[model samples]
Target: MPMVPLLICDDSNMVRKQLLRALPSGWGVSVTMAANGMQALEAIRQGLGHVVLLDLTMPEMDGYQVLAAIRAQGLSAKVIVISGDVQAEAVRRVLELGALAFLKKPTDPQALHKVLLDQGLLDPSQQTVAVSRAVAEPVTSFQDAFRETINVAMGRAAALLARVLGVFVQLPLPNVSFLEVGELHMALADAQGNAQLTAVCQGYIGGGIAGEALLLFHGSEIADMAQLMQRNSADYSDMEMLLDLSTILIGACLSGIAEQIDVVFSQGHPQVLGMQAGIDELIRVNQTRWKKTLAVEISYSLEGHNIHFDLLLLFTEDSVERLSRKLAYLMS
Candidate 1:
């Protein structure tokens, strides 16, 4: 039998390598790799592979786009979706877009092998290592601790928002990173696809720590948010609703996070960065102003509703060392 073509797509080199390692090395499969959605689609069009291992959150393009391209062009490639976003809604979205399977991150080898076998893509004669599942949980590190810390804070924020609007909010897995400021916008997968948005910015300082919190909403979110607040959509301006929503969500979230970290924050008034502006035009500061920053991002959506938004908290590079110390203290 001829070797089958398999394409691995992910932005992280480490993840791609891990995916390769998880497979049987002796299988008659020719592996090709792509770093992002565009590259993945190009490879498929070029006939480099017929089976794709696609990741959801990537800079430049996301898995949804790649899957859509596959469906549009009548490509024969089969896609298995992989991501850390375990929300049932997120999984359902990927499957709805033409993915053949979904696997959450840090995929158990047993489960992965089972997926391949069930898909009839695994060769029974191949030799593969039965790796042990003895590794400590990946979410145990300081980074992950910070993620969990913000996750709890996010839940509090959701509850507060729910009470204020009397509507349930769809929570997402928070993404935390220490990355270059120029690369910050690329970190938001849910927000990047929109053509236009309205964003609000607020400053906060306390306990010798300072940073900015950004609340972004898709252009269509204003109506849903206003309706949730039980207001006539035509009565208030979009900016008014945007600021009000940002104040409630960002204020509660920041306070909850500060309390957990044993700190305090004095928040500044919400500033309308832009209403109905492209994301690139929303940033009031220079892109490269800070070489790097510590950031926490949460993509929040309303359950059974079309409302969705993202919250990004960015701290200057100088503050991260101190922040790391605080995270370590909390871990202890």
Candidate 2:
């Protein structure tokens, strides 16, 4: 059989260049590029490719709109959403719209290849398992190792945040759990119920970093966070204070993770949302298709400090691919 043709759609030439650079060599695949969704659709309509690598945030016609149009036309081509938007609702929405998979920005080459292979777009003969493990071995050992790593990383993050706020930080013991998409609502509900204050930030991390990261706070710690940011400034409103706190806390957390992961993340502006309302809306939006769950939860506390925040590292299915690649490398 002839190799599959791949279509990459992104507004950024830089991103397109990176994708070309990162794709595996000798894949017997033909790659084509488009500047935006309209171009992508036009290419598809011309039957130029059987698979599409799509970006969600394009001008004129975004990935979502393109996907809707493709479905309306009953296109058979497989689509993989390559985006930086990590919002649960957004991921869920795209996957529901018939996307074959979702790969977050800065995708790992090994993982992407595996996704292609799993979808039968790439020949299995060209694939290799990056990690060596006995088939009979229980998977729990791998989970244990990853759980420890995440605990250490989160612990360092909590410490860094505590220092920035000059308050005591308490972190819950780490737990390893797998979740289905449908169970996401329950998982997020439980996470939100215990949180006192929530603040979110969007940014990019790693080489060519271009993605969003959210830092959630508990309700009780909201006031403390406001106070910490206001300590040095006099004329800041509640909203301003919240934004400042998000900047500080998210910066600290991202810095700590970067140090551990050996990656650099560029910071972006912070956005504060109504805690309960935001979580509820997210749950409602994703409840339909994201019923299966797979996530790791960590809790931390800032004691003797005015604000307490819970840092959640929410990972979608695409994140799992990224995590698997990272873990394989670490194990190696």
Candidate 3:
């Protein structure tokens, strides 16, 4: 069978190139690129490409909107979403909207190749894993090791969400960093942007490691979430779904991290921070309590919807020393 035309879409120049560059040599597919949802939609509408390698989080148009448009127009393109939006709801939403496959961002060459093979988009005899620099080299750096560890945990969280929502979750690049709370907003400026936002803060502590997991949702995306949760967009329904989404994503994420480090976190009740346009203004918590925090941020986007969110697993200063030692153990 002839390989189908592939359109790689993402806002990041590196990611777009990574997807295109990682393709196997002599693969019979034609390739193209799109930087945003609008551009992706236009490309598909104009028959520029049929098989899309889509990114979920983008300005103007996101993967969710592009998937929605593809479904609305009944496009015949086989869309495979390759993004970092690992939320379970996001995965299920896109497949429902007609995605052929869902792969995580900075996707594995083996995984990408497998999707193509299974979809009959490539001849299996000629398809082989294309090893790229993007592959994890855990022992090379402490950060890389932790990223891999969290990447494993992120997959566990995604699997849980997939089971519950009956959808495939897009695994995102887990951001492992050391920063002060005041510095976090700038670090995540692109993900948060100027969109109105809502957040769920859950505190976790165990084995001398303690911190908060903050799940931030786009305010305008609440209605889409309500619909995904199969509930009316009433105030009560919204709150209920918000709580439900928080419990699953946060719980699974924290649990995955603890399981890897061989520790357990006693979680506190999730606090809803409500909605506001200004992310800094919307958060009511004091940042100065901790001089620095270990921030593990995952930017999540729901496929086939106009929503993108972040799951920030923030560890306190005192806990970092202990957490570092524990994380170091994995590298041994």
Candidate 4:
């Protein structure tokens, strides 16, 4: 029997490795892994991908563009999208672009096997073997594991927001970095660029993990946000709207993360960090909070609307070791 040409494409090394570990042991397949859409396309063009397992949120190029490109060039690769972006619109778009199936992140091995067999991509005889639980590869870094964790949480938060607002939420690749206080300020400044903002901060701590979650909104977009929420601008104060949004997004996002890492966070009361202020002003006020920290930044926008917001999860420097240990347990 010939080995099936299987390709797994995802931006996170942890997730790619997870997929590899989920494959049926009895199925004969030569696996190829791509870290991004560009590499996935290059491998496909070189005839390395007969069955492509793809991810949606990625740098350089995303899975959506890859699907479109595959269709345009008439590639025979059958794509099964494995993504953390589980929004209805995301699923619809990928299916329309020619993905064979859409599986949520942290994919179940039995579910994946079923999809392969149902799609006739796997032989029926392979079903005799149960899925493997062995960790086939080491996670490349703590950052990859942490970012993939937040990616799933980010999708949950977005899905909740979308359901409440009756609008599709556009998700970005969650950026994870460890930086000094000064570098953190510069990064935030570059992202906001002097725009007036309303922001809230809430702290969470439990089981040796502690961090602050900051939700930032552009002041100019408040009116559009009010319109979407069906609240009259004159009746609802801007502060009220900002706090409401922060509670929904920050609370949901943090809860999602805690669920995945097997911890519960007792959250501090949400505090208004700044209203109609610049990024520098906000950072200056809170500069003494930490010397260096791990920051996970995610931006979300409402489809067909002018509403946008950014969520930042800042874990203290001392918490990195705890986080790495927790991630190791989860991956195991």
| Clash count of each predicted structure | 0, 28, 3, 0
Candidate 1: RMSD over Cα atoms? 9.9
Question: lDDT by residue for model 2 over 1-332, one digit each (tens)?
Answer: 46557788876554565566556664666677887888999989888658898887666888889999999998767999886544455577899998999886555788888788788777666544232211121222445545545544554555555556655455454565667755666655665576454556454446432334456666665666667644555566666776666666557655654664566777756666553346666556544523543355555555565444555544444444455555564443
Name the better of 1 and 4 by lDDT.
4
- lDDT string for model 1 (131-169, tens) is 333222122356755665676577678767877776666
Give the least accurate 10-residue stretch of model 2, judged by summed lDDT: 129-138
lDDT of 3 by residue, 53-99 (tens): 88876678778888888878888788888765566667777798888
State TM-scores per candidate.
0.54, 0.46, 0.55, 0.89
Q: Which ten residues in a row have the lowest lDDT in candidate 4?
A: 129-138
**Model 4: pairs clashing at backbone N, Cα or C within 3 Å:** none
Question: Rank order by lDDT, top first?
Answer: 4, 1, 3, 2
- TM-score-superior candidate, 3 or 4: 4
Report the lDDT tens digits of candidate 4 across residue range 1-332. 77677889998888888888888888777788898999999999988899999999888999999999999999889999998888888899999999999999889999999999889999888656554333246466788889899999999888888887889998999999988998887777765664567678887898888877888888899888877777765768767877787888898998889888889988987877644455566576667765798999998998898778889998877778888888995566
Which candidate leads the pack in TM-score?
A: 4
TM-score (C-alpha, index-matched) for candidate 1: 0.54
Error of 2 at 133 (Å): 22
Regions of model 1 farther than 4 Å from truth:
1-139, 185-195, 232-235, 275-289
Query: What lDDT does the true structure give each of the candidates?
Result: 0.73, 0.62, 0.71, 0.85
Quote the positional error of residue 67 for candidate 1 in Å.
31
| Global CA lDDT computed for model 3 | 0.71
Top-lDDT structure, candidate number: 4
